[model samples]
Target: MLGRLNHVGVATPSIDDAVARYRDVLGATQIGEAFDLPAQGVRVCFVDTPNSQIELLEPLGPESPIAKFLEKNPLGGQHHVCFEVPDIHAAKAELEGKGVRILGEPRIGAHGTPVIFAHPRDMGGMLTEFMETPREGAH
Candidate 1:
């Protein structure tokens, strides 16, 4: 099943603005640099916290999934919450056995580990992402 809360994905129209807010206003110090995740169609950055991290996602293009999300809320907002799993495959099977509808096949995530998303409906409105735990020294 789920291990610990990994990171919360926040969709933003601008990753730079989000990063500034988290750093200046929110007083977050361990912010990571923004980078392109072309495969996910997003420009991402991470703000590390004591317990978990905050992932800032900005659409890479008009057709990016986050762009559609931005259309609904121009300012952008919380998109999804990711939790770590010891074994993603087993967790997927367990969730599926309990009738949860996963969104797609397991794929490499921003953390460089396999990930899968459970449907929002099954997760009670908020999209849920499951990421396999990274090995030592890995993100």
Candidate 2:
């Protein structure tokens, strides 16, 4: 159902500082910036590395899922593990068929990708997001 670990989402209150720290100081390459979902209220920037990317997430509004997470945790850190999937809808169906609790339906994600999330309770207390990269010619 899931392919490779696509990226790791890290919640941070200050995305600017995080980008600088990871790119300038740590020497990671800057890939690009993106907004995951308006409903989710998250703006993310990617820091490229040899193997993967560092996804820096900042809440766009107080009601954002990340904001609520920050309110309780206070300390910003790794939030979720994103897995690359061949087909998001199929993956969601497979997971749901296996009794995994899905948070929402597959929707257009950052960079026009298709994605969905699974509840933490269904993933051994860890929030998991599944993403399907758009085909080269399709939006």
Candidate 3:
């Protein structure tokens, strides 16, 4: 089962611009440095919030998934919401039993944790990600 809200993924044309807004306009100070996940085809940065995090996602290449999202919403918007899970495999099995369509196998996510995505249609038109939370100080 899901644990907590891990983060909200936002598709953006530029991470720099999103960081600027979070920093200057929202007064966020605990922003993490932007880094590229070439395997995932995304440039990512995390803005820490009290309860969760805001994941800024930008296309890493022309074939990046976020590129298609940006094309649909030129200004960008919420792409997905990640929820923490104690055991990813268990969660996957449970969801599978319920007939939910998973996007792919659990893989290493930007946070260096095991993560898997559920199809949007299966999740009420919203793509959902389940992340296995790392142990304390593991990250």
Measured against the true structure, the TM-scores of the candidates, in listed sequence, are 0.96, 0.89, 0.98
Worst 10 residues of 2 by lDDT: 30-39
Candidate that scores best on TM-score: 3
Which candidate order results from sorting by TM-score in descending order? 3, 1, 2
Off by over 4 Å in 1: none
Model 2 spans with C-alpha error above 4 angstroms: 34-37, 137-139
Residue 71 alpha-carbon offset, candidate 2, angstroms:
1.2
RMSD each, Å: 0.9, 2.0, 0.7
Write candidate 1's Cα lDDT for 14-57 as tens digits. 99899889989999999998899998899999999999999999
**Per-residue alpha-carbon lDDT of model 2 for 1-139, expressed as tens digits?**
5587878989998888887788777987656765556756998877767776677888888989899888977767889988888888889889999999998788876647888999999899889989996578963
What candidate 3 gets wrong by more than 4 Å, as runs, is none
10 residues in a row with least lDDT, candidate 1: 1-10
lDDT on C-alpha atoms for all candidate structures: 0.94, 0.81, 0.93
